[model samples]
Target: MTQHILGGCLCGAVRYRLTERPYNSGLCHCETCRRTGSAPALPWAGIACAAFAITQGAPVAYRSSARVVRSFCGTCGSPLTYFHADKPDKIDVMTCSLDDAEAFPPTEHVWVSEKLAWDVLGDGLPAYATGERET
Candidate 1:
């Protein structure tokens, strides 16, 4: 059976679907992610752009950085996806937006160097100081 993962914005205005299981599932502690989601960390799952499709309302896009573009639901301000120019074929979807978020737990923590000083990371997932993990 073909796998389909569905998700939508808080107001249900924006909806999306993934045709396959995503990869690079992780928690991002980057300052941009923290501020964008208004949370301590943002959980994300990476997938090929071809595997993702917006099935509902269009999301408002914002150029978060010179090389990055982020989208969200204009009606409810729910962060949706993050795209980087460097990775033209891939995009990161906010895991929390998934209908079954519990099914995709983060595998590691990235950008931990930018994490809040008081934010305690007791999950014990491998923490990386930066986005480039030593492979």
Candidate 2:
């Protein structure tokens, strides 16, 4: 049996589970992610939309961009999931929100072109100027 990976919002108002192992775990330094998470970068783990489930309370959704929708807990304002219409089959869950965040460490850094000047990438992870793909 596959072990479920559980996570939730800070206040526990929103709970979610990943039915399968996540992939493409990375840190996103895009401006939108920085603004939404109020951090230099946002770490996320990607999984099939069918593999993710919101098992508890509903989260408030915000259309952060024309094709992007971000969800967060209304009670504690913790960012939860990010959905991009371009990749309808996949969704990214905030790694920091996971109950065992340390278990899903990021293997790469994305959107480095938008990374803050002061935010150093000393972790030695592969970094892409834009997305994960090489140009």
Candidate 3:
């Protein structure tokens, strides 16, 4: 049986559902993610764009960078998803927004170079200084 994942914004103004499981679950320590999420690192689950669908209110989008856009609940200010124009097929959903956040565990840490010294959250997972893991 396929498991369906349901999530929404803080105020429930925006809700979404994932018809399939997500991959590339990780914690990003890049400055962009930290500032956007107002946290040391942001946990995300990468899902195919086709598998994700908005079930409730629409989220406001902000062009964070030249190729990146972030979406948040306009009514409740809850950060929701991140998208890169270059990778239109994939969308990174904020793990915290998931109804059952505990069910997803980060498999790796990315952008460790920008990771704050105080933020240490690695449970034996692979760490990458940059986006792609060094071979």
TM per model? Answer: 0.97, 0.97, 0.94
Give the per-residue Cα lDDT of candidate 3 at 1: 21
lDDT by candidate, in order shown: 0.94, 0.95, 0.92
Error of 3 at 107 (Å): 0.4
Q: How well does model 3 score by local distance difference test? A: 0.92
Q: Lowest summed-lDDT stretch of 10 residues in model 2?
A: 126-135
Give the poorly placed runs of model 1, Cα more than 4 Å off. Answer: none
lDDT of 1 by residue, 26-104 (tens): 9999999999999999999999999999999999999999999999999999999999999999999999999999878
Mind sharing the TM-score for model 1? Answer: 0.97
TM-score, cand. 2 vs. native: 0.97
Candidate 3 lDDT, tens digit per residue, 82-125? 99999999999999999998878899999999999998874899
